[model samples]
Target: MSKGEETKTRILQQAAELFNQQGYAGASISDIMRVTGLQKGGIYNHFQSKDELAIQAFDYAIASISKHYRIAIRSKRHAIERLQALIAVFGSFAENPPIAGGCPLLNTAVESDDAHPALRERSQQAMNSWLNLIRRVIQTGIEKAEVQNNINPDEVATIIVATLEGAMMMSQLYNDTVYMQRAVNHLNHYIENNLKINGTS
Candidate 1:
């Protein structure tokens, strides 16, 4: 990459970490400059304003998570294994978080709900992407005869998304990973028993 490209990437990287740690409202452009050792002019040369930076940072965060998921789920051939891969991803939050802050999707959704429309839209897009992925997985399971034909992909997708996000919030609130694990475990059982064809109860 060119020197300018490198500097711009550095700024985005630092900004994403700061936004994740301090939140969009809590973290300032000055704070980002301080962390990146860039002058105000340097930042402005790349990003027009903090709002723009926050959106870019949010994108960067989502990209990071997507990259992780792509790599993590690549080897799994079975839809059930792919679904289990998601649980493993969440399970890792207890031990190793991919980002400094909690889940960016959750953080941005909650923080931007009232304050920033752009950020809120971005969060909504991220969630829809997640739900779409789950829905596709369920559809695949149905095609493979692993999941029942009558299973509602969208409904299951919503339940999984809601349950996982709620679990993450509760886990963060209590500073306990066990809450996430329990939620995921129950989700796994639900998928296995209810959705799977001839699944054992």
Candidate 2:
């Protein structure tokens, strides 16, 4: 990468963490500068405004998490295994999050609801992407006859994603991992008993 590209990436990386820990409104330009060791002019040369930088930073964070998911679920041939991999990686957030604070998508969704329309839209898109990933896995399972035909992919996907996100939020708030573990465990049971074909492994 060129010097400019490298600097921009550093700024985005620092900005992403700062924004995740302190919402877009709470994280000021000075804070970003502090984290990145960049001056105001240097940051502005790369980003038009804080809002623009925020949108890019949010995308950067999402991309990191998405890349991890892609790699984690890549080799799983079975539908249940793919879904389980999804759960496992998400649960891993408690111990090894891609970002500093927690789930960037969840945090931005709540903080940017009425604060920043662009960020909120980005959050919505990230959620849709996640939902689609889950649905695709479930759909593939049905096609392979590994999952029950009667199962609704959309409903099941929503439940799994929602449950996991909720578990993460609660775990963060309570400063405990039990909530996430319980959610993950219950999700495992649900996938095995409800989604998987009775005789299939």
Q: Pick the candidate with the highest lDDT.
A: 2
lDDT of each: 0.85, 0.94
Per-residue lDDT of candidate 1, residues 40-119 (tens digit): 99999999999998999899888888877777679987777788787678667655777777788988998898789999
Candidate 2 wrong stretches, greater than 4 Å: none
**What are the candidates' C-alpha RMSDs?**
1.9, 0.7
Q: lDDT score of model 2?
A: 0.94
**Which portions of model 1 miss their true places by more than 4 Å?**
199-201
What tens-digit string does per-residue lDDT give for candidate 2 at 1-201?
999999999899999999999989999889988999988999999999999999999999999999989998899889999999999999999778899999999999999987689998999999999999999999999999999999999999889989999999998999898999999999999999899998876
Relative to the true structure, candidate 2 reaches a TM of 0.98
The TM-score of candidate 1 is 0.93
- Say which candidate scores most in TM-score: 2
